[model samples]
Target: MLLQIKRLSSSYGRVRALNGVELNIEEGELVALVGANGAGKSTLMRAISGVQPTNGGGIWFDGADITKVSASKRVRLGISQVPEGRQVFSEMTVEDNLLLGAFTRPRLEIDEDIEKNYVLFPVLKERREQLAGTLSGGEQQMLAIGRALMARPKLMLLDEPSMGLSPLLVDQTFQTIQKLAESGMTIFLVEQNAYVALSIATRGYVMEGGRTVLEGTGQELLDDERVKKAYLGV
Candidate 1:
């Protein structure tokens, strides 16, 4: 497995956010986690990225234990996160933001990686000199994904990629995600949009009350009666 979460639990001050959450992602698989608001989906993503403190259980990546690893070290270990809000550097130019994602790399290697991202997101190249804040929401979302890609992560943790997008933009965003997966990037996606998440997922898990309540192939979850009623609105 590329990633593993064993009975993981996390909290925000007094309230628990994740409780005994078990998940695994194999290499090159596109895995999706679907849940409702406050289902602790983002918290789990945070825990996996080593940004959130886990009160219990373990996080293992590529056969090593990294439950106590710092977030930056985790990034060096090939994990990167694109947070829910496209939290790009508003005042910085688009190229600057992409440049920052390669902070750990050698200076000579950064430019080449940036060029790779521009190919993935040609619009970002067009806006290379423009301030990131000036882009439209869809463009900003693309920028967010591109920024994370700049890290050259083996596993990308995406939190709500479809959030706040129009129906058209959502389709486009998921298409981009699908393409990334098709290119063999291991992706762990957390989304409130169950249908969209499952549609492109190779396998999926359902989170509720901070626990994983279901697991199956993406189509199986989509066909599941319980999933249909609670998440898919079937």
Candidate 2:
């Protein structure tokens, strides 16, 4: 396994958010976690990224235990997260914001990575000098993903990448995710859109009230009657 979460649990004071949640992802695969509001999907992602402290359990990445590592250290260890909100710096130029992603790397490599990101996101290239705040909602999301990619991660944790976008943009974003997976990126996706997520994912898990209630191949979950009634609305 490229990543492993063993009996993971987390809490916010008295509120228990995760209860012995277990999950695993292999290298070069796209795994989707789908759930409704307050399902603890985001909490799971934060725990793996080393931001939300785990009350118990272990997080192992690339054969090393990182259960107590800092968030910055996790990023350096090839784990990158594009947070729920596309938190790009509004005042900085698009290129500058991307440069921040590579702050852990040497100065010479940062410039090279910025050029690589532009190639990956052509729209960003055209507006490299423009402030990130001025971009459209979809464009900003792209920039956010690009910023994470700047770190050259082995595993990318995505939280609701399709949130607040038009249907067209949503399709585009999912397509980009598919392309990334095809190019050998390991992605652990947390999304509310069960239909779209399952379509692109190789395997998936369903979370409800801080617990994983279902796990199967993407097609199996899509075809499950319970999943259809609750999530797919079929």
Top candidate on TM-score is 1
Clashing pairs in 2: none
Instruction: Give the top-scoring candidate (lDDT).
Output: 1
Estimated TM-score for each candidate:
0.98, 0.98
lDDT at position 30, candidate 2: 98
Candidate 1: what lDDT? 0.93
In order, candidate lDDTs are 0.93, 0.93
Please, what are the lDDT tens digits per residue for candidate 1 over residues 1-234? 999999999989989999999999999999999988999999998888888999999999999999999999999999999999878998999999998888866799898989888888899999999999999999999999988888889999999988889999999999999999999999999999999899899999999999999999999999999999999998
Task: Give candidate 2 misplaced runs (Cα > 4 Å).
Answer: none
| lDDT, candidate 2, 125-230, per-residue tens | 9998999999999999999999999899999999999999999999999998999999999999999999999989999999998888899999999999999999
In model 1, the runs with Cα more than 4 Å from the true position are none
Sliding window of 10 residues with minimal summed lDDT for model 2 = 103-112
